[model samples]
Each structure stands twice: as C-alpha cells, then as structure tokens.
Target: MAAKATEKTNKRDFLNHLETYLSKRDGVDKLLKISRYATKIIIASSLIPETTGSLIPRLKSFESSVGVSRKAFRLGKFVQDINALRASRWESNHELVLLLIAYGGEGFYYFVEQFIWLTKSGLIDAKHSKLLQRISAWAELIGYVGSVSLKIRDLRKLKDEENCVASTIEISVSRGMAYEEEDEKMKKIKEKKTLKGLSIFQDLADGLMTIADIRDGKGMLSAPNVISSAGLFSAIVSTHKNWISC
Candidate 1:
C-alpha cells in the first residue's frame, strides 16, 4: 500500500511539472523545434518505405508548417537580446565584445526573420524571400560563432574554479574537518560545466545547419541526412536543458 501510494505521488508530481513546462513560451517553442527537426529527420532518412507515395510530402509539409510556426513564436524575441546587450555593457571587455557580436547578430537575425516569415506568408514580396533567408542564415551563423566562443571561455574559467574547489575539499577532508559545503560547491560547479558543454554542442550543431543553409546544401556537411541529424540533436539537447530548468 505504501509503495503504491508513493508511485502515485511521483506520477502526479511528474504530470504537474510537465504542465508547468508546457505553459511557458520557451517550452512550447522547444517542443515545436523538436517536432520540426524530427520531421526533417524522417524525411531525410530511409526508415520509412517510400511505397507510401504521399507520406514524404506530408511530412515535408508538416515540417515547413512547424518551421513557420516557430518563427511566429519568435516574433519580438529579439528584444530579449536587446536587454541582454544592455546588461552586458558592464561586463569584462572580452565578454562585452562577444556579447555584442552574439546578441547583435541574433537580434538582427530575428528582426529579419519577421520579414522572411511575412514573405513566406505572402504578406511581403515573394522576391525578397531568398535574400532575407540568406541574410538570416548569415546572421545566425555569426551569432552561434560568438556564442560558442564565449561559452568556451566560460568553461575554462569554470574548470579553474572547479579545480580550486576540489583542492579545498581534499585539504578539508585530510584535516578531518567538515567538507560537505565544499563538496556541494563542487557538485554545483560540475553541473554548471555540464550544462555549458551541452550548450556549446547545441550551438555547434545549429551552426552546422546554418552553414548548410548559407552554402545552399552543396557540401558534404550540407547533406540532407547530416543537416537533419544535427538539427535534431540540437533540438533534443535544448529540450532537455529547458525541461530540467522547468
């Protein structure tokens, strides 16, 4: 009876958490991102037998629809970077520069993406679509580059901090003093490092997709399967990160 009750409690807690996660804008966006990339992967992969003539086209249509919806969700999202840039002005010079490049690039991408979305929706000239998409891809590439560089620097600092904390933990343990606090601090640092590493990987994956776009999918890296796989990996990593935070 006790075990059954505990299981029920855990299930209820999970459902509540899931509800909370789905309630946020970012949460919904991440889910849609996952859906969009997963659809792409299916369309690129051979897992589905082509005997079903209409399946691939339907999947492509779904992916495209999800893509447009994701853009709509991101409408006005560039304001976040504006605020981030504002807050970053007082940071270290290196950080400030990277933040400027990263946020500026992302902001411009999102700003231009609005028009691209409009063009796709027939609200703007269809002739402008290709140019706008190219510009957006380039901006996204720049933003990811800056973001990855900044994260690498941050990871290095975290590594140093982790080493310092580990040394303190060793000394405390040898002296037979309480080391619980140091141990906890080390755990937190490790968690942060892990998250940062995941973020870097996600950024790199997204950057690869952007490169594929900028190159018109001509190179080896731009292969449909490779691009879809990278996009799906990025979506899963981001979704995991967002889910945990929720």
Candidate 2:
C-alpha cells in the first residue's frame, strides 16, 4: 500500500512538472512557432496546380466581397489584431471581444476548404461530413486557437514518429552491415530485419508526405475571410472569458 501511494505521488508530480513546463509563455510561443512553420510546409507541398486554380479564384471573390484588399487578405490582419489585444490589458477592449466572435467564422472557412477537398477526393465518409461542417461552424464561432493547438499536437507527434522510424531503420541497417561477414545464415537474418525496418521507414515517409499535403491545403484556405473570422472570435472570447472570471 505504501509503495502504491508513493508511485501515485510520483506520477502526479511528474504530470505537474510537465504541465508547468508546457504552460510557460516561452514554451507556448515556441510551440506556436513550430506549428506555423509546419503549417507553411504542409501548404507548400499540397497546393497542386489544379487545387490552386480552383481555390484561388474563389478566395479572390470572397476578398472582393469583403472589401479587404488582396494584400490585407494575404497578410492575416485578424491574427495580428488579436495578437495586439493579447498584449494589452484585457479590461478595456470590447471591440476585441467582438473580433473574437468573428474569429470563429474565419476558422469555419478554413475547415470548409479542408472538408471540400476531403469530400471531393472521397477521403472523408459521408457520415462524418455533416459533423465536420458543424465543427467548422463552431470553430468559426469560437475562434480560440484551442482546436488549432490540438492539430499542432498531432503534427508534432507525427514528426516525432517519423524521426523515430528513420532512426530505427538506420540502426538496423548499420547492424546488418556490421554482421555481414560473420556467417551466411546470420547475414540473411540481419538482412531480413534491415529490410523490414526500411519498409517501415518508407511507410512513415509516405504518411509525413500526406500530412504536408493537408497542411498546404489548409494554409491556402486561410484567406482573410476565414482568418479574420477566427481571429476576431478568439480575441473576444479570450478577453471576455478572462474579464468575467477575473
């Protein structure tokens, strides 16, 4: 009983330490920076000519309707505005709160573009289609960046797995080669193990490629319409939530 209690205490302490580490302002900033870069890379790889042609024209139409210049649309003004509010004292910003409400709308746009791609490609089933649409609507309404943070966690996990698989492949290959001169039977066993490891590495590489493709599609979809909506929503909700509770 004493041992079990000690183990539980240790686990709680470890979790507390982890939460503290992750919650620090610097840690959050670093995570955000990493996510942004990952998203950029994904966008670059997924933007095929056909996808670009279809999406860009629609994005332009949306921009024109909103009366935001093409340059402002591209520059993510909403994100900038929310970021400014984040730095300011939360007590005095009602406009920022309204912006947060609209931020959710922007996030909806991003999800819509993603859903369109998935639906057209037949990657997502019809059953989940409506659910995704609803989630997108809520995201647009909420605009808190929490959903994006969950996605960032997924991306980071995928990246870490890819690295681990690569390392395993390298280690297996090195061992196989090192033991090649010992005996024919041993060499065959080592070679087989190495080949299996290589196959796993290749599969991981393909999965990473797919992630990159998804990221690209998302970034391109983030025109001012979606981005602004999300930014405004995030600002309002975060500020208001903080204010009411404080």
Candidate 3:
C-alpha cells in the first residue's frame, strides 16, 4: 500500500519535481529500462499458446488487487500506504524510481503470478463485461486528461511563489516593487509564467517567429502566439480523440 498525505505541500513541490524528474538523464534511463523489460515480457508472452488470450486480460484482476486496494490503508500505519505514492522527487528521481520499483514492483509481480496460477488452475472466472470495460477505459482516459490540466494548474500555483493563495491577498500586494519588463505582470501577459520547457508536446517553435515579432515591437499579442497556443491546445484534443479511436 501507499501512504496517505498527513500534510499537503504546495503544488509546486509536485509539478516542479515531475518536470525535473522527466528531464534528468538517470530518470530517463530507468524509464527506458522499464520499457525494455516490459517489451521483452510482451514478446515472450507472445510465445504462449494463443488459447491463453492476451496477457493484458489476465492482468485485470491483478490491477484490482495491487493497484486499487491502497484506499483502505492509512498514512504511517503501514510502512507503505497510499501516501507513499509520489511522482519523482526533483532532487532524486533515480532513487525515487528505484524505491517504487522495489516496493511497488513486488506487489505487482506477486499478483501477476497469482493471476497466472488461477488461470492455469481454472479457478479464475474472467467476467469483465465488454461494455463495462469500455466505459471504464473511457472514464480513465477522461480522468487522465483532467489530471494533466490539474497538474498544469498546480504548476500555475507555482507562480504564486509565496503560498499566498490560502492566506491573505496582502502577501502579494506587500512584496510588489519592480515595474520592469521582466516583472511577473509581463510574464503573465506573455503567458509564459512557468518554465516554457514544461512539456515537450509544446514548443516555442512552429509559430516561434511571433516571439521575434514581440521583440521587434510589432504587437504584444500577435498571430503566432494565438496560432501556437491554439496548436498546443488542439494537440491535447487530438491526442484524446486518437486514443479513443484506437
């Protein structure tokens, strides 16, 4: 089980950590290794008799046991409960990945082995309704997209810098000073609050010429900013539609 959150930290701690993690060399290496191992597993499973069906269908019950049961666990009561679940820590992505693969991986493989056994012994009844399965997948896809927007908002909280949202508006008004072009107001107007490199799916290119236009004093908001923003937005929508199509 994962641990519960006793204290909620600022959203910056989470989003920044994910950004840093995905950017690191060691973190990428681990994900690559995990991918390689997964690929090998799938390839090996292909050698299994076709009558056994897809390995994924066999893993459904395993997901219920190993993935969903963390709801019952409390923080600190179990060494690893729901709270133990975290995205990569910004400082130690490699170490964090190792810990999850160590603790979480054990439960994952154990249940998968159990699934194989039950299938072999004819003790398992595969009873997932096709419509229910489709709905579940659809709901999960919706939740996944919502989570992307949620994290984007979490990153937006990062612009607050002082954790001032829960407190008074005075915190923001008090520390204000600069009126320079580099000020927060300018950044917000440019819509580049957080790091521009947050996601690879978005880039300053494509309509990157607009950035030059702003520099040349053409207009603050021009065709390229609108075009690039619309492109990125549509990328997300297209991805969702393509996923559902498959």
User: Best-fitting candidate, measured by TM-score?
Assistant: 1
Candidate 2, residue 71: Cα displacement in angstroms equals 20
lDDT of residue 87 for candidate 1? 75
Which window of 10 residues has the lowest lDDT sum in candidate 1? 87-96
Query: What tens digits encode model 3's per-residue C-alpha lDDT throughout 80-198?
Result: 32244453343366544544543353333333434443543446554533333334333333333433443454466555642343233344346674334335444453344333223
- Please, what is the TM-score per model? 0.92, 0.22, 0.24
The residue pairs that clash in candidate 3, if any, are: 1-80, 1-81, 2-81, 2-82, 2-83, 3-81, 3-82, 3-83, 3-84, 4-83
79-122 in candidate 2: lDDT tens per residue? 54355445644333554454444344454445454664465346
Instruction: Summing lDDT over every window of 10 consecutive residues in candidate 3, give the lowest-scoring window.
Output: 67-76
Point out where model 3 deviates above 4 Å.
Answer: 1-124, 127-129, 162-246
Q: What is the Cα root-mean-square deviation between model 1 and the actual structure?
A: 2.8
Candidate 2 residues lying further than 4 Å off, grouped into runs, are 1-91, 138-246
Clash-forming residue pairs, model 1: none
Clash count, one per candidate: 0, 20, 10
lDDT of 2: 0.43
Off by over 4 Å in 1: 1-12, 89-91
Whole-model Cα lDDT of every candidate shown, in order: 0.90, 0.43, 0.39
